[model samples]
Target chain A: MLSAEHITVRYGRLTAVEDLSFRLREGEWLMLAGPNGAGKSSLIEAAARGVPCEGTFRWQGEDLRSLKPALLARRIGFLSQKNQVTYAYTVEEVVSLGRYAYRAGLFSGRDGDGGAAVERALEMTGLTALREASMLTLSGGETQRVFLAQVFAQEPRVLVLDEPANHLDLNYQKQIFSLIRRWLDQPGRAVLSVVHDLSLARRFGTHALLMDHGKGIARGPIDEVMTPELLRRVYGMDVHGWMRELLAPW
Target chain B: MTETRTLRRERFTPLTCLALTAALLLTMILCICVGSVRVSFSDTVTALWNGAFGLPIPEGIARNIILRVRLPRVLCVALCGAALSLCGAAMQGLLRNPLAEGSTLGVSSGAALGAILAVATGFTLPGFSFGGSMVLAMIFAFGSLVMILSLAWALDRSLETGSIILIGVIFTMFSSALISLIITFASDHTRTLSFWTMGSFSGVSYPHAGALGAALFLFGGVLLRFSPELNALSFGEDNARHIGVNVRRVKLILLITVSALIGVCVSIAGTVSFVGLIMPHIARMLVGPNHRRLLPASLFSGAIFLLLADLTARTLLSPIELPIGVVTSIVGAAAFVVIFYRTRKVRR
Candidate 1:
């Protein structure tokens, strides 16, 4: 389980996210949906320990504020909105970097079993075919999948993805979500993804957090949080009939 | 299967790189041995072996020629070349910019200015001599160090990699103006400072070679040991920090390492241009940008390139020897044009 208590993240004098509080249990998938400039990225960065915040966060009852980056990285994998790589490293090389925290000793010597982990991640992400290809040559969808392979390689307890599906096509979107679903099926793993696509949130999320003006306006199970009235109120659009048809199968 | 394949390729790259390095070393030895004085390969090898092992040799002019003159100059050329290239590779990795190098950062000019001041003022101290060009070189290097550190500190807040490169250009211009001002009112003895500005490997001696080789080897080892951190840094500071790298500490160490290497090279061989800037680029083109491969490759390639450039400088106008700096600039400019064209094509 992961919890953030009264997290207030500020940059200089500007408050990006204030008094944000949330929690997630194991085997759960939570989606954070917000309009542009809604501080979703900042909130996710704060949660990932990429930014400093004035509050306490706990992972499985341990205070994350005191955890070292190497320790935190092993337990929580973060995929930022922008993946900017300057080196000419191959896909395998990039994915293998996920194992850096696992390395031990002076040179961070490779673990004898890391090969198997990397191979498993490649297989899971359907990236085995492109393992040796240069990352510079990869298409947008393929690059996203490669990064997903890296996250899978990390084997983190908590998976935090910020706009993981932005550049991917519909097929890749489904593939990524299915992978997340598999991760969430594990007994002690939770996935928190920031997404802009409402349709994907409706299809994949078990719970939803609707945010606006740097605050959470709604947080509950998907059905209640994504109601027609709430959707109209949040998005300022007519969705009564649409919501009814969308929820019919559920 | 992929692991085995990648391992095999990885093994092959270093082996090939080593083989090329050895070949270059052999070429440098041959260049050193066969100079303006017609000395046979066997005689030159015998003289070198006798000198190295402290063995007795026949009392002849060949022994004097090899021992007194050629060896020290060759060693200086190779060390300076290797050190400059290695510094360039590290700078490129730290800045995450292909064009970043010791000369690009105004380190060379700053070091030159310091050296000039040392000469003009005759400031000699313990463990250091301000007697001649060597003192000037040391002072120039010290000045360069201060300038680079100050610029690095001023830009620490922004911490944007691009801004560092811009700051380097600005410093280069500022240092160049200072050098020009000093040159305008210089005495005859100081006017010879132009020789230091335009590099020459002509007056190299055993003591200079020893000092330079020691500095290069010590600092080069440190840079190579931190190769993995450099690899992480090329991805950007935030990402490197996220991966458990001490970004601030690494930056300071890297700057010191690069500056020291460049400073020592400029002190020993004047401001030899393009070896630091071009060798790393060439190494990257060959082995990609993994610093493990890039660093060693750049070192070897830089040594070979400069040694050959020195040969051309001495041999092109046989009796009237050209400055090694002139050869480097000419060769380096042409090489840069070619690389620029290739990069443009790749971008398109």
Candidate 2:
């Protein structure tokens, strides 16, 4: 289980995320939804320890601040929205980099299980066919899958993905969400993903948090968070008929 | 069959590097043997062996030239080459820029300025008897270190790799102008200072060879030890830090190592250009950017390249004996042009 208590993130003097608190139980699937600059990304980044924040976060019973980066990486796999790899590393090589925190140094070559782990990750992400391909040559959707494979290789307890569905098409997005759902179904696993598409979030997310102006507007089960009143209040869109049409299947 | 072919190709890289290293070493020995006074290879070998064994060989012109003059000069050339190349590789990794080299970072100029000051001051104390060359070398090396640190501090926010190169160029220009001004004012030492600026290994002695060799070995060892950290830094500092690398500390250590390496080379052999710039790039192209392979390959290839360049500089014009710097610049420029054209075509 992971919990954030009253987190505040400020960039210079401007508050990017203010007084945000949430908790995710084991095997839970949570989605963060907001418009551009709604502080969804900032909140996730703060939680991932990529940005500095004034708050107390705990994974299990231990303070998140006390854990070293390598230990933190072992417990939680973070996938940033900006996934730019500068080198011409092979797909397998790129994925293998996730094992960096697990290894002693960059070139220790001591982990005998590395090859097996890489193979398993490639199989899970359906990237076995592109394993030998250069990361520089991959398409956007394929690259995202490769990055997902990297995080999967870490075998972390919690997966934190910031805007994981940005460059993906509808089919690829569905594939990704299904993968996340399957991952969360495993024992002692949890997932927190930032998502934009309301329909997809409605279908996939077990719980949702809606943010507006650097503060949470609503947080609960998906049904409660996706109501017409809340949608109108947060997005200022007349989604009454749209909500009815969207929630019909659910 | 394909597996066998891949294995064969993989085996060839190390084999090729070894072969080149041996060939260059042999050529350097041969060049030393055959100077203005023609000493046969057999005679040269005998004199060298006899000298090594402390045998009472015939005291003549051949022995005198080989023992006192040619040996130290050849050793100095090899050491300078290796040191410059090592510095280049480290700079490239630290800056995370492919074009980054010792010269590109104003390290050579900084060292040069130090050497010039050492020469100008003519300061000779009981402990420091080497005069301006040694003092200037130390000063120049430290100057480069300061420049790199200041650049790192100033560009803390964005940390664009190109800004480092631009700053390096600015420093290089300033140092060169100051060196020129110094040369213009010096009386009888003007010719000597000018010769040093052009960079020659003609008059190297045992002490010069030993100093350069020691500095190169120490600094290069430190660089090789941190190859893993270098590989991590290539992904950018933020990513490296996220993966638990001490980015700032590593950068400072690398700066000091490269500065010291380049400093010793400039003080001993003057300012031999382009070996530091071109050798590491060639190594990267061959070894595919992994510093583990790239560092050693660059070191050996650089030494060989310089030894040959020095040989050509000495023998090409025969009696005239052109400066090694001129030869290196001409060769480096031509090779760079060819590489640029090929890369452009491939990209197109």
Candidate 3:
């Protein structure tokens, strides 16, 4: 289980996330829904241990900060929105970086029997055909799949994705979500995802957290917290009945 | 399955890298053998063996040339090449900019300024041969790096990578101007300053070779160990951090290490250019940007490239001895243009 308490994030003068507290257990899929500038990314970064924040983060009853970076990375995989590659590496090579912590000895190198894990990840993400393609040659949707495959190869217990489907097309969106669903089927693996599309969140998210200006306005099971009244209050719109159905047909 | 696809990519295997390394060693041997006074291959080998084992070989002209002169010169060239190339590779990886190298970052000019100042001041201490001068050069090289980094930080309101490179270019220009100003005022040391700036392998004794050789091995070992971290860094700082790399520590180590290597190179060889700038790129082309392979390959390729350049500098005009820096600059500038065009085309 991953638990965070009294999380406060500050960027110089501005307070991004103030006193935010939440708990995420194994097999739970929590969706963070917020408008722009609502500090969704900030919270994800803090939880991922990528930035400084005032809070206590624990995994399986152990303090997150106390764990070694490599050990923590093995348990928690964090994927940010932008995945820039300055040099051209093959898809397989990029994915193998997920196994960095597991690599042993000096000059153990990347081209070894770690193929089982890498091949499985590629197969899961449907990137088996493009496994040898250079990352510079990949399209946007293909690159996203490659990153997803990389994270899967890491085999982290808690997967934190910040807008995984930000720039993907509809088909890619469906493909990525289905992959996440397969991941969720496994025991002891949890996902915390920031999503902009309410329909997708309503469809895939097991729990919902409504955030506005860095504060959680509502949090509970998906069906209970995504009420029209609360969403309207948070979004400042009359998102009731027909409007709600139109936004989230499922 | 994509098994066929993997076969088609033709990975740059370790064996290929080893073969390249062997080729470099052969070239170094050839360089030592075929200098102004061609001490035939067999004679060169015998002399080198005799010198190594301390067996009594006639102290003839051939033996002296092989043992005292050409051997030290070649060793110095090899060390400079390896050091500069390693620094270049590390700098490029740290900045995430392929254009970042010793020459581009003004490190060469900075070190030149330090060495030139030492020459003009006639700075000498009792019981030390060029030690004080080398110390001054290293300090100045370190100062130049600090200046470049701070200027980049202060000017980078958006913290763009390109701004840091631009800041380095500005520093390069400023350093060049200062070097020229120093040269203009240096009356007594004008010839020495000019020759030093041009760069050569002349008068390099065993002590000089030993110092540079030890530095190359020490710093090169550290750089080779950082391949995985460098691979992580190629994905950008945030991603590297997320992947459990201590990005700050890596950057710090890279900065200090590369600066020191550059300092050592300048102090020893007087600022040879382009081995650092171009060798890494060639290595990347050969083995991809995976530093695990690229770093070692670049080190060998650098040693070869500079040795050949130095050889040409020695033999092209025979006795006239073209400055090694001139030869490297010509070849390096040409390679840079070709690479720049190719990279731009790839980007487009």
Best by TM-score: 3
**Comparing candidate 2 with candidate 3, which one achieves the higher DockQ?**
3
Which candidate model has the greater DockQ, 1 or 2? 1
List, residue by residue over A1-250, the lDDT tens digit for candidate 3.
Answer: 8888888899999988888888998878999997888888999988777679998888888989898777888888888779886688889878877776666665554434456767889999998888778998998888888888888887889899999988989998999888998988999999999998888899999998899998988888999988988888888876566565676856
Top-DockQ structure, candidate number: 3
Judging by TM-score, tell me the better candidate of 1 and 2: 1
State the lDDT of candidate 2 residue by residue for A108-168, as single tens digits.
5424555566677889999988977877678778888887887887778898888888878
DockQ versus reference, model 1: 0.43
For model 3, what is the C-alpha lDDT against the true structure?
0.81
What TM-score does model 1 achieve against the real structure? 0.87
Tell me which residue pairs clash in candidate 3.
none
lDDT (tens digit, per residue) of candidate 1 on A1-250? 8898888889998887788889988877889987776678888888876688988889878898678766887788877657766557778876776766676755544455667778888998888888878877888778888878777777788888898889788898898888878767878898888999888998999999888767888998989898877777777777667656878999
How would the candidate models be sorted by TM-score, starting from the highest? 3, 1, 2
Interface RMSD of candidate 1?
Answer: 2.4
lDDT of candidate 3 over B109-177, digit per residue (tens): 787778777767888557656666676677788788878877877886533456766776787778767
Q: How many Å off is the CA of B230 in candidate 3?
A: 0.5
Given candidate 3, what's the lDDT at residue A25? 80
Candidate number of the best lDDT: 3
Window of ten residues with lowest summed lDDT in model 1 chain A? A105-114
iRMS, model 3 (angstroms): 2.7
Which segments of model 1 are wrong by more than 4 Å? A61-65, A236-250, B1-18, B118-125, B130-167, B184-193, B340-348
